[model samples]
Target: MNASRKLTLAAAALALTVGGGLAVSSASAEPAAASRSLVTTTAWAKVAANGQILGGQGITGINKFGIGRYNIGTAAGLNGCALLGTINTNGGNDPGPGSSSILVGQVNGNTLFIRTATPSAAGSAAVDSDRPFSITVVCP
Candidate 1:
């Protein structure tokens, strides 16, 4: 993994996440959810038909069916609203529809989907590589 790939959250937010705690004030406790920003990309590690990593490219946007957030690593933010998970599939790779890529962050909370695309340099697979790939999360 990229060591420099640090999340851009502030110290308080980082602490809240690490401590598995939530700071919901009376105002935040009201019937409402925060407007979360999704962090999705289409540049992921390339995987084989059996879900093996062959190579990869840069990520782009969130998947078309990015849903819900999961707490695979943190607990301070929304219960199902963070983009922190990993998925192991490419768009239209299965017989039906999902690649079944897993993700982090809780669903319906602050979750986000990250889709990656293959690089143009990878020959033969380049066409297939340009497809959308899903990422669940690689929690920090």
Candidate 2:
């Protein structure tokens, strides 16, 4: 058997033994029902520099208005939600010299306005720049 399969079986055996039972069955088991609501209360998006969505959950659409300026649509209202954003370096790869910053804000109940900027060559001020970023919104 494969290593993963063996490990899974071993873990199951250990759980059964610890629970005071040692029965082995081949039938598929149904998952237990959750005790609380399963509705999603959070949304996330990973957008490329060109405004294309790489991958995410609960994202509806994305629009690029100008360099480093984007509007991301979400599947739910964000009236009282908290926003968090960060620069994404393409799967942990080095982004090279200089650093980028992100600003996230709400445009409406379900829309988010995102802006990205980097330090100017002279380090005097920040200038709008195209950079990949990820954002998450949590609603209560």
Candidate 3:
């Protein structure tokens, strides 16, 4: 089997063993459910100086968390300039009732900043390598 599938199976088996053991020893004899969650999304796009939405992405998780990525193709703009953009959960629910978002990771760019739910505040002194970026948002 593939590495990804093997890892997933191993995790499930471990959860069952631990959870099942706890329940069997107790009066209820019902396995407790695991609550740990992990979600990931990846997208690719050729962003412009003004900022634009990234296409070709996927999401997998419980809630529809707002995530975005942009490519600031120019290197002669202010680092704090705000541009119009949108965050998409790709038909998923919002992160929470009042949860906020922030930048978690970045690459192939001089600097990438995400505030609130936009990615237009990025700035770089030099040209960016323009590679695909992945974002992961954890919700309570």
Candidate 4:
């Protein structure tokens, strides 16, 4: 299949999964509410190109090592978590224009490493660039 088709399918699946989870959680009663503490395992962060933390939940600190490189500290360890991130091109709290890409990974149990890049003029390679981004991490 083509990349567009694969991306479409993946997005649809994610939407369904998130929608279903929200439905199930919202429908549960008091007993289930007690177990909702487990939901705290999810964390998120919005950071600027200068590594300033704009807003986030369960995020402790954000450090900029250099251009296009950052380390995010979380309130809890993320030993077995799924990390997702995307560049922020929308102008607002985190303002930036043009297209960019981001890469997120776990550097340690409680730290996540992020790298940002922009496509080269020839569109043949990616060059490291400073860009704002948002990230989400879900741990089990």
Candidate 5:
């Protein structure tokens, strides 16, 4: 099978597994009645195009509903700019049971958004975040 077909099939499988209980908490809407599951991935240290390793820290974990947080700990590499985020299951393809993680309150400056699945108005599910997320800097 082609890459596109494989991605589509993986997405479909994720949708069927997560179901409707998973949702991204919107600013205007109230938090969903159902609680969310938290998950964490392996940490990524500061890596640059050059051979130098700048000071940086990362915490990969899904907060609620598959919405993950990749927090950057150090300030050296962060230039008031945008970054990319991706998510996947622990097995890299299977969205099954996993561990949980979260913070009490306050949106920290380094906190970034990562979602495992997106819901459509027609009731269909769009699976985006699934196992290993590749996060990078779009700007300097």
Candidate 6:
């Protein structure tokens, strides 16, 4: 797909995730009912440019997620940010072949994000074996 289309889908996916998360946490909100604390959390995925991911097939790498942290009060500080990230390939369209990686996530207030902006030379691969993989971030 084109660049803009990819971004749109990503955004939609994020909305669904954050929306679903609210329901799961609804049970916990009961305890804070008397405290007047309002909590909002968001999670999203970040994808490396096809070029960056494709290049670092068999290489050690460092990627970047442009993120920051925020919160409006004492009761709602960001406590945790983590990421479950990986790529997969059957080895066809793209040449880079690699597995998934779990890494620390970036913090932005109660918001969370992750991305692999940099790709370096790995041990045995030159081109990314996976064409399209996902990077997922979560926060609590």
Winning model by lDDT: 2
lDDT of candidate 5 over 50-90, digit per residue (tens): 21223334543323333332233323234454454433232
Tens digits of per-residue lDDT, candidate 3, 29-122, equal 3446766855322222222222333432222111212233342322323233322233334344333223233443332232334333322334
Off by over 4 Å in 3: 1-25, 40-46, 49-140
Q: Which 10-residue span in candidate 2 carries the lowest summed lDDT? A: 22-31
- Ten consecutive residues with minimal summed lDDT in candidate 4? 22-31
Q: Which portions of model 2 show Cα errors greater than 4 Å? A: 1-41, 92-96, 122-126
CA RMSD, predictions in order: 19.2, 11.3, 18.9, 16.3, 24.1, 20.5
Off by over 4 Å in 5: 1-79, 87-107, 118-131
Ten contiguous residues with the weakest lDDT in model 6: 66-75
**Candidate closest to the true structure, highest TM-score:** 2
For each candidate in the order shown, give its overall lDDT on alpha carbons.
Answer: 0.35, 0.80, 0.34, 0.76, 0.37, 0.36
How far does residue 14 in candidate 2 sit from its true spot (Å)? 37
lDDT of 3: 0.34
TM-score-better candidate, 1 vs 5: 5
lDDT of 5 at 10: 63
Clashes of 5: 7
Write the residue-wise lDDT of candidate 2 on 1-140 in tens digits: 87765765776778787884433444433323446733444799888888889889989999999988999999989887889999888766524348778999999999999999876433433477778999998776
Collision pairs in model 4 = none
Expressed as tens digits, the lDDT of each residue in 2-106 for candidate 1 is: 322232224336767788544444343322356776554323344333333355433322333312221121222333322433334355453223223332333
TM-score comparison, 4 vs 5, better candidate: 4
Itemize residue pairs with steric clashes in candidate 5: 38-100, 87-130, 87-131, 88-130, 88-131, 89-130, 89-131
CA lDDT for candidate 6: 0.36
lDDT of 2: 0.80
Q: What is the Å distance of residue 84 in model 4 from its true position?
A: 0.6
lDDT of 3 at 16: 82
lDDT of 6 by residue, 1-140 (tens): 87765665565567687883212232332212233644333333333334243332212233332221111111233465344555444254433334333233444453323332213437543322223344433345
Q: What's each prediction's TM-score?
A: 0.20, 0.64, 0.23, 0.63, 0.28, 0.29
Number of clashes in model 4?
A: 0
